[model samples]
Target: MTHKRKIFAGMSAIAAASLVLTGCGGGGGGDVDADGNVVIELAQWWEPELPDGALRGLMDQFEEQNPGIKVELLSGPYASTREQLVTGAASGTMPDVVGLDGAWVNDFAKQGAIADLSALMTEHDYDDSQLASQVEVDGSTYMVPAVNFVYPLYTNDALLADAGVDAPPSNRTEFADAARAITEAGDAAGTAMPLSLETPSGVQNQVMSWLWASGGSMLKDGKPDLTNDGVTETIEYFDDLYQDGVFAPGAFTMKEQDMVEEFTNGRVGMMVDSLAHLTMIRESNPDLKFSISALPAEDGYDGKRGIPYASWGLGVSESSDHKEEAWKLFEFLMSEDANAELASMAKAFPGNVASVPDFVEDDELMSQAFDIYQAGYPANEFTGLPVAE
Candidate 1:
């Protein structure tokens, strides 16, 4: 299967040029090991998500190819990893190569926690044009998206069928009706929404997702446009669902992981979630049946849909003594073959524009997602926002 890349026009270019911080943190580089190999510690939430030892196997290949350099993975869950990175940034003890979220680029750059990739790219003669997109801060590249996970509507076939729905909803009215019907059919809710105030990204992933799917934007001229009609209608639509009792219980406190689990356990009929969870969902419920589609739009919307996406971004620590060696790892990861391998392993879209995943040819759900992606634009407004949690 061939994928024609779509321009990332829906993603708001982060241009926080004037933001500044006073401190600099560096001194977290790895040291020489017993065998005289240069050790570089990498911290991220990606390894656990991949197949057991898949990432390790990739590192093993990297170690073999690049002799005398060792990579140590410090992997954990998303929440803990974010907390750890935040703590590391403040304490000046960040790992050499870190998995970054687009939202963290601005804050980390302002604090001087992450290295300037533009300089390193120039020094190494890296051709960044092949990269999907670079996260920038103060006009300097800070992070590169390693792989992309798109949010699509996931519907349980049994639930929809039991609710008397013929197909997945494609517009707002149908979605609401489907949700209500599914909820009325049984104990399961029509949809599961994670709106936890603790993490607050649910607002971005769930609430804002509705707006984006309908070709709406939260920004105008790079500024907040909350007062716009689109945002107002989106909020009203959500409220209508809430008033109709179509949303799963404990929505206000429900986290993203909990929402995915609910869908996996047959407690929810539908959800707009990341493709990265496809593997997990299948592993947890081998017999479960589901389908993926673009998030429903407004009734009259004929324009390109806005698909929300998150990235497994990569960046190096500002203070690492092994910046050069760390970049070699970065280069290896971004290489076409390696990037494609990672994307396939995670069931995601590659971050390298030239790297296409052949795994989609055999996977029905992923093929649908790839089609949806090619048809629409990536809509992640929080990509470079400060304090974007």
Candidate 2:
């Protein structure tokens, strides 16, 4: 299961970066015990690692290295993570540290469920730019990204070659041509788009990306604006692609996961999904060569680099007496050694730039994912509702 990473010709290098503040709120949850040892509970939705494993190895190392702090994990699936944290926070029973979704950061900050991490980051000299999903609200930093995922366009190089598509497309017009070429060659569907209008997430994969890349947004001033000019233009472009037979017939009904399978099975030329799919594809379609890049945009439209920001991150409960201790554990887990463990175990990339592991740095495909994620985009967490526009 080897992947040969691709580099977009004539594309400049990608830059990565991330935020904000208020409240002496780090004093409520689990705290230090009578033995002068701090006991911090970290309840996260990230699998600690993949199935059949956990992040215990890294924690074990951390505990051995830092004798005074004891880190406890409250494990569960991501589906119920937010509910658990929300209920716990409301009851003042939340863990010392908790896992957060990108969309939850702002609300939690407003609720004062999480502590400000600026001071802690500064004190530890943590280079924050590495965080793919660092959560900031109204200019204050609330959380540091951990298990982050980015939805990038993955193309099957072999399919593209077989279709005689010599180069990747940088704009929609060019992309359509490439897609047409692939379809005409009969190697596979040019692309598999996720467009099940059944859910907001479906819309995101098939459309929101284009809006953001074209300088439009799903949320403006806290309200949903579905009729923005950029959105309309994107829709028109999508319509053109559809009419041209650039997308598979099932694309309009397929969920994101289904499209992922289409790409891996060689039934589709490209897939719009998480970089994690690479590992999955490696297992399911071992001989495939693929490359990933940000979704294509109009040639002059911000060069089509915009996309959404999403991740799982570490946050200290507002009332944790052991804020410093909690941060210590976080820093350790996000360190180079421990972060690498996360990649191998959880199929996650490092949230800290300094901790990028070899598996990423050594592989062009994986390395490119880090670059795409770091290249900031006009994003909306798209939580529940937008503020009044």
Candidate 3:
């Protein structure tokens, strides 16, 4: 059978297991009590392995605030979390609230598994602009953006200075020159871009950023435009960068963490990564002097500097019977203070635009990151492409 079919089969098994567990009164599907206390299961992928506890803590706080509601956090590995959610939706056993990546919103929305949060926002007087465009589709909100991270060039300032470079590159040409200088210094690998073919996430991330920087998008009016000059140019740039020995020997096999670790260990002078790396850098090396700046632009392209904003949002499952309570939980999470607190706890940037100013005031790297985010463009969404299954 096809890979998708196999995934579906595995998901079906998981759903069946969940049903059996629920029937035995060993899971989160128990009925509500007379005290108005409702047990709501929240399916999420932020397990201990992920290291982000803000979401969990937020849920705990919600439970405390609303004594009548109890939220059960269901954590799972990232590999099967999405599949489980899809299966839950299909089987009408989805959790009350779910933490999902913005990219997955389109797919779930298309499947009619997510509720229309626009009405809730309107009723609550919530400002939609606080959320990113990706979470808002066709004038109806489907999710509450929790945290956002912008992709930027991470530079080791001390290493650059040791190599006689005063600052990070501002444009593509300057970056190329600096990479050569660092490589010639003979201290370590000069510059590394994630050129790993094995890790499609890295490849896609880099390509999408370059594509945006080159004044091109993945889809123009909802159709793939592979023949677009911008797309071709970006791909060719990666091929050339690979052939030039700028990347590590097995960069094609390098994952995101691997690349970040290399830069953190001083094995690389510069690396491109998400802004969320700020806290990791601080924790990994307290003395490390690194700076985050916008990715360099193509030589002559005058378009906005592009930084991919990676984020997750909270959404109520349409299969849920407690959407009102779920919305209350969602509203609490999206509140300014709540978002700020979670962002600080998670060591991540906030999704609420208003919270950006607060984040900037406290974290310098986040300040620069906010600048990049404001100057960046949104991720491209195509209409005709089949959503990932």
* Best candidate according to lDDT: 1
Off by over 4 Å in 2: 1-28, 31-34, 51-54, 118-133, 197-199, 213-226, 301-304, 307-309, 334-344, 361-364, 371-389
lDDT of each: 0.86, 0.68, 0.69
TM-score of each: 0.80, 0.78, 0.81
Model 1 Cα lDDT, one tens digit per residue, 100-201 = 999888888988989999999999999998887778766789999899899999999999999999999999999999999999999999998898888788
Runs with alpha carbons beyond 4 Å of true place in candidate 1? 1-28, 31-39, 64-69, 76-84, 91-93, 122-127, 183-188, 265-267, 283-287
lDDT for position 283 in model 2 = 92
lDDT of 3 at 38: 87
Question: What is candidate 3's lDDT per residue for 72-170, written digit by digit as tens?
Answer: 777776545676676666666667788787667777777778888887777878777766443655557776667765678888887788778889987
**Decoy 2 TM-score against native:** 0.78
Give the number of the best model, judged by TM-score: 3
Q: What is candidate 2's lDDT per residue for 179-293, written digit by digit as tens? A: 8888999858898677776544767656777666555666566555667777778888878888888787776677878888888888898767876667788899889888887
Scored by lDDT, model 1 comes in at 0.86
